[model samples]
Target: MPRTQVTGRTGPRRALTVLLPLLLATGTPLSVGVPASAAEPGAVRLPVMPSRLAAGASCTSASHEVATATPWEQRSLELPKVWPSGSGAGVKVAVVDTGVSQQARALAGRVTAVGGATADQDCVGHGSFVAGLIAAAPVKGVHFAGVAQQAAILAVRGTDDRGVATDTTVAGGIRAAVDAGARIIEVSPALADRSRTLTAAVSYAAGHDALIVAAAVPDATTTTMSTDTPPRSYWPADEAGVLSVVAVDAEGQAPQGSPAPRHADLAAPGAGVIGIGPGGTGHFIGSGASLAAGYVAGMAALVRAADPELTAAETANRLTTTAYPADVPRLDPYAALTSVPDTATHGEKPAEEAVRLPEQHTDAGTTRRALLVAGGGGALLLLVVWASAVVPRGRARGWRAAARNRPTGTS
Candidate 1:
């Protein structure tokens, strides 16, 4: 796919407004074209499998860099200082991307498929790479480890083998991750276009108080001719309540193709970042905005583990505000673990009382919509599923927020 200049959209999310109307009127399904660097099984070089398996094989020597590569990488982000307090224990980060490989050593027994079935397996290797960045176990002989070494991975496959997924599939993946008890969701695709399905899914996750960490720009792109018609933008990342992440190098400089400063919430080291790869590649170099997003997701996990009582937005706010610069913050795992949370509780007093936001939908209208959804057929099925599944979760989140903020004496 050729790199296109920005159109009126000015970011990666162009033509979404146009894509939504076409989906509803013509019922045409638009597919997401994941960047080749992020997807394509044949394109990704898997590690050479060992003839005989050892107890804890990591293949550390296969790496092109020195053994100290990973330690330096972690030090750049200041991750060591926070590991003792919270290695993301008791946190589940939903990875929405290519499926995760079950046999990746760093992720052995750590990955959970979203559905009850034996799915969420990765063929293209991208999802496994992303998963390792968030929560891989420490390799026996290598200096490498995930940012949130103890966090569990909720693997949800949105894209197919070719790294192509429809907006509907991506949306469903987000909802599934939330329902599967993921506290932090890592959306690894930077889709070429946008859809109502994806927007609704984003809202559903936010309403349920789940933090969304999304990859932006080059890691996600459109293979269609419309990609030539820019203001280039990437979806889900551009959506509200989602943390947009960009890739930086060890020097902390954002790359050329990443989301502009205005579009990104944080940056993390992605250039030459070492990650355990799919099909037992042990640990290798991976780079992109997707990897950067994975780092942020891991940080969110650490923050949530420090205090599972935090709301999604509250957790995200802590990470963003305490970053290295505080403004356009860079990922600072140490600060996320040590800093005071915005919603900290002390002596039974509430800090700033939460103002109740208006309900997403009035009761009568919701009931009417539910009835219509049940009565309708074909295309309406997706909407009906969302109503049945996401609505209740949203309501439960609201109640939880209310109870957390309820006055000490008032009934």
Candidate 2:
């Protein structure tokens, strides 16, 4: 089998425009002005963490540079608006990667190593960075935080200490995560070849009601290859019962030379992404499909926490169905949490039970604001009338929008 090395590139951050309305509607605090920390003199600079190390490379060092600006993904995902309803509480997400470090301060007291104590040691720092992207807690004065701050992490080593992954190790990691009762298993390795064992592992996870999230392509390639190399499938991403994720930048564009996967279920903020490394208050910059998978897994945790009754398949469906329409749908975490599924499209009769928000979690004012946001300040009655007329027509047309029909692009 032929292999191509994937590379990481940093892109300029663009401010997200659509989230402000939702944030105001939810009463989530927004920091419009620059923080005092950004102006401080002699701030420590952060390093870029490597996805893998070459032979004889020294172990990754801890970063001391703290990030003060909020990551673009935070604003793009509208995390603040969704945090009030679901903080991924009680959800167990497995990070099947190099390993997750116990020394990461934000992930302290939340990570459980699956294979052994060695599984808690992240020499490459890739696993620890992915874990931070999923569940790192809020730190005072730092704007960077995980998507699911309250979710528990199950660290399983799918790669060796130097960050090389094999199908056997990755297969075992998936099974281990399933056996550990993880609600969501995030597979960071994007192996070049598929294996029966890995396919079976994905099946086993689905059998046990675990949602498996995987990177659509390798984060970093080991050797240089031509940019025109045709796209290929990687596993267990190519396997059934998996949600394959690709990385996109703040501008919703994939990095140059990114391998286009045959079947990417979602695109997330992955390029030029900021995260914490092992044993650090500081942050590191990383990019690729693996990091994108982390974001999807965190969003899955939130959906599972928000609606505990949703099955693994149902949860995956909810995420894809509510995603912002695109060639490969862009993840909209807020929509995944709040939007009701369109069951009629699934050929199932609509349930008679009314969908109700938990009053204990949402006040009357918040509810009114949400309604206003949905209706664009029009009367709720008018919105309902519009939906009644348009929804049936949308269903008749198979819900195919003009955007979805456009030429497919990478990420």
TM-score of each: 0.65, 0.74
Best by TM-score: 2
- In terms of lDDT, the best-performing candidate is 2
Displacement of the residue 192 alpha carbon in candidate 1, Å: 3.4
- In angstroms, give how far residue 402 of model 1 lies from its true place: 80
Per-residue accuracy of model 1 over 3-25 as CA lDDT, tens digit each: 21222322222332223222322
Among all windows of ten consecutive residues in candidate 2, which has the lowest summed lDDT? 16-25
Query: What lDDT would candidate 2 get against the real structure?
Result: 0.79
Cα deviation at 291, candidate 2, in Å, is 0.3
Residue 329 in candidate 2, Cα distance off native in Å = 0.5
lDDT of 2 by residue, 1-411 (tens): 122222433322323122222321232322222221223465334566677776787778787667687777788888888778778989999999989999999999999999742634788898999999999999999878898999999999998888888999999999999898999999999988988888899999999999999999877442411245567898999888899999877677665445677778888988667788888687876667899999999999999898787888889999998898877888998889889755564557866877778867589888888887877856777889999999998998899873565566845
Report the alpha-carbon TM-score of model 1 versus the true structure.
Answer: 0.65
